[model samples]
Target: KLTAVLTYHVVAGKVMAADVRAGKVKTVQGSELTIATAGGVMVDKSKVTKTDIVADNGVIHVIDTVLMPK
Candidate 1:
C-alpha cells in the first residue's frame, strides 16, 4: 500500500524530512527514497503534501505520489 510505503520512508527515530541535510531513507519495501526540497520535502518522486495524521500506532503523511520500492 502507498501508506505503508510512505510509512517505511519514516525512520524509527522520528526524523523530519525538512531537517535532512543530505541523505536517503530506506522504505520497508527496501526502496531508497531520496530526501530533498523542490517545492517542499520530497520522498523520491512523491511530495509530502500533508503531515501528522495520527493513528493509534503511528502517523501518516500524505504524499503526491505512491512510492514503489525499486
Candidate 2:
C-alpha cells in the first residue's frame, strides 16, 4: 500500500535537477509520474523544493508534498 506510493516518487538512474524536463517518466513503482518544469519542477501536483542530492546508489529530490499513487 504505502510502499507503492513511496516507490512512485523514485525515478530510475541518477537523474539530476537540470537533466529533468517536462515529460512522463516511469517510476520505480512501475507507475508513470508526470514531470513538469514549466513553472518549476513538479511531480503531479507536488512541487520539487530541492534536487540533486547525490548518493552512493542514486540521487534524492526533495518535494514539498508526498506523492500518492493513483
Candidate 3:
C-alpha cells in the first residue's frame, strides 16, 4: 500500500515542464494520473508547486497534496 501510493507520484522517463501536456499520464504504480495545464499544472487533485527538479533517474514535480492510487 505504501509502495503503491509512493509510486503513484512517479512517472516514467524524464518529463520536463515544457513537455507537460493536459492529459492522463500513466504512473509507475500502474494507475493513470490526470494532468491539467489550464491556469497551472495539476496532478490529480494536487497543484504542482514546483517543476523540473532533475534527478539521477528522472524528473520530480512537487505537489501540494499526496496522490493515492485508485
Candidate 4:
C-alpha cells in the first residue's frame, strides 16, 4: 500500500548521500524531499545503506529502515 511512497523517495538516477545534500529532489509520487545532514546523512529515519543500483529504467538505493509520511 505504502510501497509507492517509499519507492518514490528514490531518485531515478544514482544519488549518493553526498549528491543528495546538494539539493532538493522530487519523488515519484510528485512530492519533494529535502536532503540534509541530521545525526548523519539521514533520509527521514532511514540511512542509505547501499547506493547506485542500476536498473534497465531506473536506480535503487537501499535504506536501513522504512519511512512513514506525516
Candidate 5:
C-alpha cells in the first residue's frame, strides 16, 4: 500500500517543468496521473509546489498532497 502510493507519485523518465503538458501520464506504479497546466501545474488534486529537482535516476516535482492510485 505504501509502495503503491509512493510509486504513484513518480512518472517514468526525466520530465522537466518546461516539458510538462496538460494530460494523463503513466506512473511507475502502473497508474495514470492527471496533469493540468492551466494557471499552474497540478497533479491530480495536488498542486505542484516545486519542479525540476534533478536527481540521479530522474527528476522530481513536489506536490501539495500525496497521490493515491485508484
Candidate 6:
C-alpha cells in the first residue's frame, strides 16, 4: 500500500515545467506515470494545478487529485 502510493506520486528525474513533454516517467516503485501537456500537464489521471515548487531535495508539482496505484 505504502509502496504503491509513494510510487504513484513520484517520477524519476527532475522534471521542469518547460521540459515536461508528453511521455511516461518511470517511478521508483517500478511503474510508469503518464504525462500529458496538451492543455496542461497531467500526472496519471490527476491534473497538475501547480508546478516548480522548489524543495531542498527536488521540485514539487501540486496535483489536483491524489494518485492511486493501478
| lDDT tens digits by residue: candidate 1, 1-70 | 7776555665554444444544576665566678777567776777788876666665667788766655
> Listing every candidate in turn, what is its Cα RMSD in Å to the true structure after a full C-alpha superposition?
3.4, 0.9, 0.7, 2.9, 0.7, 1.2
lDDT of each: 0.65, 0.89, 0.91, 0.64, 0.90, 0.83
User: Taking the candidates one at a time, how many backbone clashes does each contain?
Assistant: 0, 0, 0, 0, 0, 0
Which clashing pairs does model 4 show? none
- Ranking of all predicted structures according to TM-score, beginning with the best and ending with the worst: 3, 5, 2, 6, 1, 4
Q: Residue pairs in steric clash, candidate 1?
A: none
lDDT of 4 by residue, 1-70 (tens): 5777665675566654456573467776666666656565666556767876767776677778776544
Q: Identify the superior model by TM-score, candidate 2 or candidate 3.
A: 3
Candidate 1 segments whose C-alpha is farther than 4 A from its true place: 1-22
Clashing pairs in model 6, backbone N/Cα/C closer than 3 A: none
By the lDDT metric, which is better: model 4 or model 5? 5
> Model 2, 1-70: lDDT tens per residue?
8889888888888899879989899999998988899988988999999888899999999999988888
Q: Candidate 3 on 1-70: residue-level lDDT in tens? A: 8999998888888899999999999988999989999999998789999989888888888999888788
Candidate 5 clashing pairs?
none
TM-score of 1: 0.64
TM-score against native, each model: 0.64, 0.92, 0.95, 0.60, 0.95, 0.88
Q: Order the numbered candidates by lDDT, best leading.
A: 3, 5, 2, 6, 1, 4
The global Cα lDDT (0 to 1) of model 5 is 0.90
Error of 5 at 59 (Å): 0.7
Better of 2 and 6 by lDDT: 2
